[model samples]
Target: MDAQAWDERYAASELVWSREPNRLVAAELADLPPGTAVDLGAGEGRNAIWLASHGWSATAVDFSQVALDKGARLAEGLDVTWVCADATTWQPPAPVDLVVVAYLQLPAADRRRAVRNAVTMLRPGGTFLLVAHDSTNLTEGTGGPQDPAVLMTAADVVDDLSGLDVEVVRAERVDRAVTTAEAHRGEDRRTARDCLVRVVRR
Candidate 1:
């Protein structure tokens, strides 16, 4: 979907996502010391707000101005900078300690650009973490984009960051609990297949 489509969604709903941080984000990063972070494609700033609340200075970037506006309103005293820009082309002015690319579904070429840019924006010894819908979710798991082209696997992330000077801490498919609301079912809890990648710059 494009920025306009996203804006329409945010405009229609008061909250497009939950207030809590992504499961993989909290699980993998909660233990790390606070530092500067960039939440690429940060829809509604959920992750960015959580990072700021946890002592990290965060910058949230998204193409949808509507989403950024909503996030800014929700992030009243937090240390978060909201930027309305495309993640694939918007380069951060300086390298940050952490860069998070979460659930930004796009075509392979576009996704490759965004992922490469994310790694490029990381400082030396900084970390680049990615959590996204796995391609297999369409058939094997529940609740995610139905299009295969928009979803990716852990190996895709490894290939996207192939030349980067980084240490892969974890890269694999993981399962996340899908609630009834997310699954569009009545009391049927399911698992969402997701790809998680955690890499530290060398």
Candidate 2:
């Protein structure tokens, strides 16, 4: 979807996504010491807000102003900067300790650009974490975007960040418990198969 379409979606609902951070983000980064971080394509700024509360200075960037506005309201006192800008084009003022791009679905080419953009803003020894609906999710999993071009895989992530000076911590597909809200859409739904990738800059 384009910027206008995303904005419309955000405006359609009081809140599109949950307020909590992604399960993968919390599970993987909870042990690491907090630092400067960016939540690229932060839909409603949930992850960014969560990071700020967890002692990280976070920035939430998205192309939808409606989402950013809701995020600002939800993050009254936290140390978070909300930026209504395209994730593939925007860059932080300086390199940060962590860069998180979660569930930002786009075409393969556009997704690679966004992932590379996030990776390029990471400082040496910093972390770049990403999670998305895996391509197989369309066929095997319960919920996610249906478009194959927008979905991702572990290998796709590895390829997207190629040539970057980074160590691949973990890159694979994993099952995530589908929320009750999501499961209501259909039957035989319990988990969402997603691509999880974590890397540390060298």
Candidate 3:
């Protein structure tokens, strides 16, 4: 969806995503000392707010101004700057200690562009982490984008930044449990497959 479409979606709802950070994002980054960070495609600044609460100077970038506005309201006194821009092309004023790309699903070419550009925004030793629905999620997992073109895998993410001076800390498929109505009734279980890529600029 484009910015306007996202704006409608965000404006129509109180909150599109949760108030807390993504589980994998928190688990992978909590160990690192707080620093300047960017949460690219931050839907509602949840992760960015979480980072600020933990002492990181965070920036939340998204194309939808409506989403950013809501995020700003949610982040009233936090150290987070909300910017309305295309994640595929947005550039930070300076290299930061961390760049996080979460669920920014796009076509292959655009996804590659965004991932490559995100890596460039990282200073030496800076971390670049991406979490998204795995390509296999459409066929083998629970809920996610049904379009395969937008879904990606760990290998695809690593390949997107191939030849860059970076060290791959972790790249693998991870499972996220999604509570379903059946589960609430103690009937069935479901999981969403997601690809997680964590790298450090060398």
Candidate 4:
């Protein structure tokens, strides 16, 4: 979706995504030591806020100004830097210890470019975590983007980061509980979410 569309979506509701960090992200980085982190396409800054609260100096980047504004408001006193830029093209000011790429759906080519760019931002031995809706979510799972072009699998993500020394810390079709009102109105939806993939820059 374009920035305006996302802005409208965010404007229509108090929050598009939940206020909490993504379950996968929390599970993966829970034990890691705090450091400099960059959240790419960080909508509403849920993950960024959580990272900041946990002692990580986080920079949340999003294309939509409204989303950044909302994130900033939600982040009140948290140590988070909100930057408005397209993830597919934005480059961080410097390398970071950790880089996060959450559910930033886009066409295959764009997604690949974005992931590549994010990986490049990681410092040597830095960690890169990616959490995205698996492609099967539309067909076999409950709720997610209907466009197949934007959906991807863990293998697809690994392929996008092929050159990096990535370890499949957790890669499988895991079930995600959807509690959003729109999602819950129907049968309990169990969409597939990509698990953890820990990568170190070579």
Please give the CA lDDT of all the candidate structures: 0.93, 0.92, 0.94, 0.85
- Mind giving the per-residue lDDT tens digits that candidate 2 earns over 47-162? 99999999999999999999999999999999999998999989999999999999999998888899889989999999999999999999888778988889989899999989
Sequence-dependent TM-score of model 3: 0.96
Compare the candidates by lDDT and give the number of the best one.
3
Screening candidate 1 with a backbone cut-off below 3 angstroms (N, C-alpha, C), the clashing residue pairs are: none
In terms of lDDT, which candidate is stronger, 3 or 4?
3
TM-score-wise, the better of 1 and 2 is 1
Residue lDDT tens for model 1, 82-145: 9999999888788899999999988999999998889889889999999999999999999889
Model 3 lDDT tens row, 1-202: 8899999999998999999999999999999999999999998999999999999999999999999999999998899999999999999999999999999999999999999999999999999999999998998899879999999999999999998999999999999988766645775668899999999999
TM-score of each: 0.96, 0.95, 0.96, 0.91
lDDT by residue (61-155, candidate 4, tens digit) is 99888989999999998999999998988887888999898888888899899988988898887888888878888777766789989988877
**Poorest lDDT segment (10 consecutive residues) of candidate 2:** 180-189
What is the Cα-based TM-score of model 1?
0.96
> What's the lDDT of the predicted structure labeled candidate 4?
0.85
Model with the higher TM-score, candidate 2 or 3: 3
Error of 3 at 66 (Å): 0.4
Candidate 1 RMSD to the real structure: 1.8
Where does candidate 3 stray beyond 4 Å? 182-188
Q: Which stretches of candidate 2 lie over 4 Å from their true place?
A: 181-189
